[model samples]
Target: MPRDRRPVWAELLGTLDEKFVANAVVFEHATPCAGLLLRGEPLRTETGALDRELVLRALAHGLARAPELRRRLRPAPFGLTTPAWVPDDDIDLEAHVRFHVGVVATDGPELPVLLAGRLNPPLDPRRPLWNTVVAELDDGRVAIAWRIQHAVGDGLYGMRLLDALTEADDAGAAGDAGVAGGAGAAGDAAADGPGSRAAAPSTSGASTSGASTSGASTTGTSATGTSATGTSRSTPTVPPLEPGPHRPPRSGAELLRVAWLAWWRRQEGPRGAWHEYWRKPFLRRLRRWGGRLVRPVRNHVLVVRGLTESLVPQRRYAFATHDLPPVARRARELGGSVHDLTVALALVALDQVLPDPAGPRLGVPISRRAARGDRRNHVRMTVVGIPPGTTLAEAVPLVHAAVATAVEAIEPSPSRVAEPGEPSRPAATILTTAGLAHASPAPTIPALGPTKSATNSPTLSPGHSAPGSPAPGQPGSASPTRDAPPHPAAPHPAAPHPAPDAPTRRRGYASFVPWRPRARSLGPALVGSAVLWPVLDPRDDLAVFGSSYADTFSLAVVGSRHVDVDAVQRAFAELVLGTADDVVAAVALPAPPGAGPGVRHDPGDQPGRRPDRQPHHQGGGTP
Candidate 1:
């Protein structure tokens, strides 16, 4: 019996978030996109508009379009939806977008407030996968935020939906619309702070379909030409992309097409694509599992974001390129490896922030083989150990300690006896995330990557307080390098007394793997952690509250609910940069690893790197 209506699950799947699933989807290149909201109108009046009608009407208009907010979803085999992403019960326009106008008992200018609260609530299997939030910023702007699990569809697929709903008339204007929803502008109510992509130049096209940002973690680097022993490895051939009926290729389709052609590619070597596809057949027995919930249209919320999302404008963000050539040159000067410097930097960052910081006071992801037999692009996670905080004087030795711990963590190979013939992920990953190392330590980070440890990850995002995401060097996340730990220029030169953990140690950022390949071709996405606690330390008072964002640099501020962003940024500079006034580092790392001795970090880089004859990542794992 063919049914005309979609099953309940199918409709629910339509509301699934694309960003969530793309987290797990590995990429050879291409960064993911994230949603950014813009305020259509600013509430300049202080007392707020007393007329409930217009405010309510606008709210109603936004909510009415909830179920209509749609995205094509990809279901897993056996009628199972990807574990990531969920839909909410229904949309509440007032809740999602608010007019802060409270009943002042006096009618002044119409100052309707936008609700900053959103629906990123945790969901269970019994319900759909999604959330809606009506976030009211301190300013009159409002933003609806959501975080979908990363187990659904690719970002491009999400864009297809936007194409369907968006207007082609002005499809290429990267300019802001006008006052509110206009291009490149976000008012206080617009949340995501200022200068967000939401505030970027407006999308050239009308992004009618809800926008999705994926591949939100990690930075882009030259992966093609690396100097391996002073000789470059030939760049491998990338497969071409085949255009689908639903979504056509952009004129710059060369790259994405390359990625696609690589996928489902024919097996040329000894191993062939399995003789047959494995299909789970539970539906034959109870076929109506999801079908029983079939309905004409499933009720869900629609999400939309501006192309030029703002960054809350506190501080510029960072990619691994931060130090670039300068740092690389400096590392060589110190007679150490580049990755060694990275380990040192991670430690320095931790030491600067953690209160009463003691022992390594850090976490890292170990790459282990996958549990499943598949070995395409996958990795399991494991935790690495860190000693307590060391004085800035003792930086090098401590960095070395952190490196040794990382080296030790990647040692054990996968156990074959009990787990034989199962799946095979990455070796460094499994051992780290299984919680074995986390539970065994004096001072250690919790498991995070793939499974999320504390708030932090390998690729760190700006967190006013506890900042951790699937960033590199986060616990159980991804470790960007495999190398010996090189010591920093220890101010003390001698080892410091062994220290113990402090109350703040309990609040350390959890670990995660932040290795992600971002393609400038696709723009940026969300991928980090943050935690804001109620308790303010005495240090918080001495702490400064100024600007962390300089002329060109910026970082992301995410996850934390209670972080006083300005204060946090100030603390970062005072503690990390040595002084709040020093917007740029007094001593900057070399720009682009291996650049000329005097070259500063090049802000305006071309689309690709120079076609050097060397290959930098011969044995290097995916970033």
Candidate 2:
């Protein structure tokens, strides 16, 4: 393996981030993959079966747009250097594209079960690290599930790949289609649900489409990759790959030479060779060492708790979706970003199930790529610690500040140094946001005309805000007056409460693991923590993924067997749709008889109980 014989991107091998290489190595047993699951009108043939040819054609079109899909990893011998991306000359469409014929209802357990089964297996490492399964349901609808290895690309990249595959549309048409039923029927139905359908005041005219956007969230299960009408748009010309086999460095000496060349090339700019090669590393090391000496003891405890919980191998998953505009508006009114609100919601939910004295340490993945098309896994993990007993209102600002600090301190590459007396593991709970897939010109919330001082304003509930807060020069404010009518989407003071079915309507769909009397746990010290790996780190106790599609914000919760993922999902929904008080009361209710441990009782069925609570303990079995 010589440098001259390698591909054009060969020089990047040694300079690759350690996180990227770690992701490749971890693929041996665990599948660190992000996925998209979409339900829509079935694509059929003259004989009334799934149109396999059409599906394959569309996949080929998309693969051409995303060259990373056709690339496979070529590992270094004896771990001498990072893996190199090489072109796969032959791709087996039949092996990668699969079809399952069944009547799997969107709201039923069958869909999730089928998806889990597909995700349980690892992708064929010999070829590309991506696959698709098109399922035909009994109701004449089809569900498309697409997955790609996290090592290749991230959530944003997945959205770009999806955008390339689906039918093409101008920005306006895409927005309109997304608002209608283009994204998915489930998302559309949920978006129109009571108390959650109000349009946010926007300077822009685009309606929120249900179509998955480029900024939509990518979780183990994503709804952002819907192929509207299952039609393939015309394929664009893709540049051909270099015509030769990729050869990675073989010997230790070659690896060093490659590393040195990559480093030297990076220093050729104005930064100068001496400053970059010597001064910068020394300064960074000194700062890290100083920070470690002053790092709090509580941080150490949080890391330990996360490590202890990571030993459990068995995991469960849950999914839920909510309208994004209203939530986004509410978050804005509360003086925080949508991301801040989501982090607060997740922390509150985790606190309900696992109340730690030192608070929960959250691992937030920050992307470092300059463009979405970069196939390299350029990401850094930042850990944020939330203090115990913090309410939703209190946590928002704290989380915002902590996240700001962590983001500013992130290094371009993973650091080898560890703080004294701390286990180098990821936070116990990991929270990730893929961002809005298709962003509108106007902000999610309409601009407030004018308003009084912050101290003089009325205090709103945790998840609620006044329909239209007065802006700086508005008539209702203490400042200059201006006449302006209220936005049409604003809720009236006398508006009727949402019907009892509101809870069910707020969520597009949900799936939880049934409680088993004898749930097994992976013994201690079997896996590494995310601090040393990716978000799909083997040691994670719970990982919550958030993404947006059109007007909808989707959440996917992945947790260990001992954790009650169902409870977390329910808590999050209630917190978003109802008040904090309502969540507390609902979570306090007892479970109905015959409902297994960790199963959430339907609030509609149990008249007095809230919809988010779990049953009381009976035996020593895990929840």
lDDT of each: 0.24, 0.38
TM-score, candidate number 2: 0.52
**Which runs in model 1 stand beyond 4 Å of their true positions?**
1-126, 134-144, 149-360, 365-456, 459-507, 510-568, 575-623
- Among all windows of 10 consecutive residues in model 2, the one with the lowest summed lDDT is 524-533
| Error of model 2, residue 203, in angstroms | 24
Each model's Cα RMSD: 19.9, 17.9
lDDT (Cα, tens digit) per residue for candidate 1, span 1-623: 75323222222232122212221111111111222222212312234322233223322322222222322232333433322122233322222222222221001111010111111222222332232333232222222333222222222122222222111112112211321131112111111112232112111111101001121211111244221111122222212111111221222232233333443364443344343112345553244335323311121111122111121111111111121223334444443343333334444444444433343333332322222221111222222223444333244334434433443454432442433653232211111244222211111112111221211122222121122222232222122221113333432243333334323222222221121111001001111111111111111211110000101111221112222232333333343333444322222112455666533222122123211100111000111
**Residue 373 shift from truth in candidate 1, angstroms:** 9.0
lDDT of 1: 0.24
Cα lDDT for residue 386, candidate 2: 56
The reply for model 2, stretches above 4 Å from the true place, is 1-25, 28-39, 76-80, 113-120, 167-312, 369-375, 409-535, 579-623
